[model samples]
Target: MTDMQHKPNGWNLPINQMTEEEWKDYFECRKKYDIKLSDEEIKKIIKIAMHFIDTDHDKYMEESLKIPVPPNLAISYKAFNGLKAMKKFNLSLAKETYPDEF
Candidate 1:
């Protein structure tokens, strides 16, 4: 099957990368949960989930033995928003030394 034929199973997949069915499911989910997030917020969430987290506790669920269980949307959204805000606050407090990042 082609990539488009593959089902998107995660909330972490970027919006631009989602398949057509995935987009339908995504909108349905957002509507059901009353989630209204900007594209940038969604991107920040994807970035954090894909790049920053070392361990995903959600992957441990036993749903017909699926290896990677998708993270809970409400929890992830709330946590990601708080994390984004906290990181922004922390960055403001940190000293800017030379070569802070390589």
Candidate 2:
């Protein structure tokens, strides 16, 4: 198997090995900047972090879904999938909403 095959979705971060401090850091970074880490972004980040936390992916995802989407943003089904999926759907939606962005 290739390297990607050994990794979850070819993620680069070692999230499964995070310490409590790192977990706090992650949230702090997210909150400090008021970053709207969308569902997709959050999912990817969680996958990486969970790798560091050495937790179950399904449990992590389930727990994450309960966190709620950011205010003022509507989540498309595509975002629930992954980055690429969300990109395609988001791009199309953006075009539909603001053709000028295309």
Candidate 3:
């Protein structure tokens, strides 16, 4: 299908349905040569990422019957948030040093 076929309104498509060549083009367009998210935005993204981590971990256990949950199958929200915050902070620093990369 042509790229236009995937546009719901303005050219956004479901990533899973993208053809190889179309996906390549999409990535090319998304290549940010000089864009850095603000600290606030990065923090928000990390918070969202924590939710995904929890979801995927549960999904994996459900899918793999042989896998057993540990006695303490718990994740510390505080620690994860802290680590994510630090990671985003570091990414911002790297972006400053290499002002021409994603």
> By lDDT, who's the top model here?
2
Q: Any runs in candidate 1 off by more than 4 Å, and if so which?
A: 1-32, 52-54, 57-102
Give the Å shift of residue 18 in candidate 1. 29
Off by over 4 Å in 3: 1-30, 57-95, 99-102
Against the correct fold, how does model 3 do in TM-score? 0.29
**lDDT, residue 18, model 3:** 47
lDDT at position 90, candidate 1:
14
For residues 6-83, write the lDDT of model 3, one tens digit per residue.
Answer: 321212223234455655554343332213456676566556556566568754432332222121221222123321
Score every model by TM-score: 0.23, 0.23, 0.29
lDDT of 2 by residue, 49-99 (tens): 576445576665544443334322323332344322222122323333432
Clashes of each: 0, 8, 0
lDDT of each: 0.32, 0.37, 0.33
Which 10 residues in a row give candidate 2 its minimum summed lDDT? Answer: 1-10
| Model 2 accuracy (lDDT, Cα) | 0.37
Residue pairs with backbone atoms closer than 3 Å in model 2 (clashes):
15-48, 15-51, 15-52, 16-51, 16-52, 16-53, 17-52, 18-52
Would you list the rank order by lDDT, best first?
2, 3, 1
Give the clashing residue pairs of candidate 3, or none: none
